[model samples]
Target chain A: MKLTRRKRNMALITMTPLVDVMMILLVFFMVTSTYLDLDMMPMVQSESEGVAAPADPAPTLLIRITASGEARLRGQPLTAQSLASALASQPRARVLILPSGGANVQALVSAIETATKAGAENLRVVRLEAAE
Target chain B: MKLKRRTQPPPQETIVSLIDVIFFLLVFFMLVGRMDATAPFEVSPPVSAAGESLPKGGTTIAVAENGALALDGEAIERPALLAHIADLLSKKPGLFVRINAHGEARLTNLLPLVTALERAGVGDVVLVITPNPA
Candidate 1:
């Protein structure tokens, strides 16, 4: 009796289909994700612009509220009672309340109420355009 | 002596399984994706330079911290907001509607209010903001 010898064949695999599927998924996610623009908020300047400036200056009654809940009027800090007292001196017909950023809403409301109580007829909240 | 040749089994392919894994991943992301979900209706808006100084002579609407709606500080219901705006518009054809929404307020709540203002025929709508303190 004689011994027999044999040779075995090798196998090959292709990955073209897998790559195609992954590419499709990457495209889908790229389209769906919401891109937040951090710079969307415009910067407000302390001074008013000449082009959009109103002729009469509108007798604005500026109010500033800090993040810590402090309230001020035209740079002068005031309590709720004092706010009403200061408003009483101005003509209430055209009063603008400009609250600084991070101001407390409760304080802002209180200021609005005080202004209204002081007989402010036309109260406009001022939103200045972003400085160029 | 005698010699013999042997045939090998075909290689196993996994293209279909790979595609399945990719599909599952896609579905997972889709399910967990964040849709237009914004913060709750209680934000104090930061001052922006993009917002124009409100033009003269418009009706003012205020959104309070507790989500109460007010027109000129008078409490008004959501249903009545449109009517109030409409009535105001009848008196002044070019009535501007200024929205003073709190910073904590949700954008979702504010959008519907803006749509109502548009329906009420407000030509100019201004969003009021408070500037950051020094």
Candidate 2:
């Protein structure tokens, strides 16, 4: 007499653990990530890549940012329009921003923006050093 | 005499759809979010329309309104922060330094730090800003 053989069923793989891990990671990223729309302005760059200084230095237009976040050009209040017209005459003027120590970062940034929009190519921020 | 009635069993819910949804959400978050070290204090960067799109990968230095400084999310003093940055510069000469300063932070605090970073031989340094104030 022949013995009867028993058939074995296939083992099913569970996805519960993988789902749990993914859920945890999703929550982690959602909680920890900041969703700010950030941009950047270059503060320092290698001088090697910069344009060489001309034999005749371009006229310098100094923009000052006061403690109250006002941009002043040559002691006169400077606006975007005024700066544009002023830059029209000497297009290659080196725009220097001398910000007051008490002024906020917004003031400095605003001054930079004004200079940039007025077609100033040689823009520089004149940083003040504290007295020892 | 009474007649007996049979009840139907509940159907098993499939988890394949759930796994697919979760996989898509996970991938979306990973792609959209930039994983950077956040400062212990709140830092709202200055706003400027002239700012260019921020490049990825850099060492961030956050400055609070009260002149408090943090390097890579850890609260640090000015001298110590500079020293740590100098060390990082030695290891990675092309290290990019980003200053994520609060909008109301004093220029005294920000400008000096930038000067120090430049003096430390950091070739690429950027001031983090935003196009929209909101």
Candidate 3:
């Protein structure tokens, strides 16, 4: 009499470890990541399109922002409407926003918003460097 | 003779579907979330409506509300930060720098650093702003 051998079943790989690893990674990213809606304002420009203030120069409008977030143009507090009307008169004027160093970032941003709404095509933020 | 009863196989819950979901979620976060190094301190960027869409892939310098500085997540003194930036510029002249200044941070803290960066030979620099005010 010949003895018959039983068939062996192949081992199945377990997915429990894979699932655990993935769950851990997902939580790590979700907890560590910050989702902030961000925008940019150019500070140091490399482009050559903006020529240096011409010798003759176009009409220039100086808007100064103080520490209290007040935008003063020619000693008057500037509103968007006022700035727009002023810009309308001199469409080609160069608008310069000079912000005091003591002012907060919000003050500078608000001043910039007013200038853009006023339709000033050539806007620049002038920074004064301290003497070494 | 006794009749034999057939044993029904217990239904197996498919883990493949769960894996597929987890895979997609991981990809979703990896794509949408920015991997910029956060500053040691809290830094909330200023809000602006006229800001342009920010481009990615640049060194981020975070400025906290009290003027604390962090370059690519490492808190550093101003001189050291500028020196490192200057070294980077010497290697790559057209390096782009992004200044993530806190909304409440004074211009004094932000502007001087920017000026130093410019003089350090960095050609392009930008200030980070939030479209939606926090």
Candidate 4:
């Protein structure tokens, strides 16, 4: 008896399921993810990353943030113009921000922003610790 | 008279292009959108034009306006949070931490946390902010 071999047909793979899965994932990301334009201020940095302190200490300018969210420098309301004028005389002056515990985060950020706009190179935030 | 009938071949609907478009869209979303877990409570970061662009890959701690805290999207107490972070720091000494605190959060809530984080051996810590107030 002679056996006959049957020819095989090429199989077609469907892509509908793949497209469906991808579309679902795309929608999920679009719906659940937030697109915030975030920025960051360094609160702590490694010692190696920090700039070396000057051999001779620069003059320090203290800016205080009041409880009412007002920034004061030398008994005057702190403004960009005032800060710039103050930094003009001493460009390398160390600008220290001492924020009141009652002050909100916005006040601190605003003070930092003002100082940065006024060309402050040596900036530091002084934290007040309770005495034991 | 008898008329001859002609049958035209049906048009083929190609699905390969559709698959390509969907795959591209999937890849775009995956690349552009961050998968960070958001905090349960509302946290509006302080606005600051002086801030630098935030680098990615850090443990995020969210502080709400009422001084509530959440670490990596899980609501946690201060001591517990600090303990957890200390453990993480023990494993990875170079752990980076990002604080996403609300603008209305008092300095009492923020400053102390920062000091504590520093004490916990976190060398790199950043405060998250937004350049756009809106």
Which candidate wins on TM-score? 4
Off by over 4 Å in 1: A1-132, B1-45
DockQ of each candidate, alpha-carbon based: 0.06, 0.77, 0.72, 0.77
Q: For each candidate, give its TM-score against the true structure.
A: 0.34, 0.88, 0.89, 0.91
What's the C-alpha lDDT at position B116 in model 3? 84
> Considering every candidate listed, which one attains the maximal lDDT?
4
lDDT of 2 at B113: 86
What is the descending lDDT order? 4, 2, 3, 1
Docking class of 3: medium
Model 3 stretches astray by more than 4 angstroms? A1-9, A48-50, B1-8
Candidate with better lDDT, 1 vs 2: 2
In the range A1-132, model 4's lDDT, one tens digit per residue, is 998888788897778888888889888988887888899999988773457777998999999999998999999999988988999988778899999999999999999999988888888898755322
lDDT of 2 by residue, B17-122 (tens): 9989988999999999988888999998988899999999989999999999999999999989989999999999999999999999999998888888888989
Per-model chain B TM-scores are 0.60, 0.86, 0.85, 0.91
**Candidate 2 TM-score on chain B:** 0.86
List candidate 4 stretches off by more than 4 Å: A48-55, A130-132, B1-8
lDDT of 4 at A22: 85
Q: How many residue pairs of model 2 clash at the backbone?
A: 0
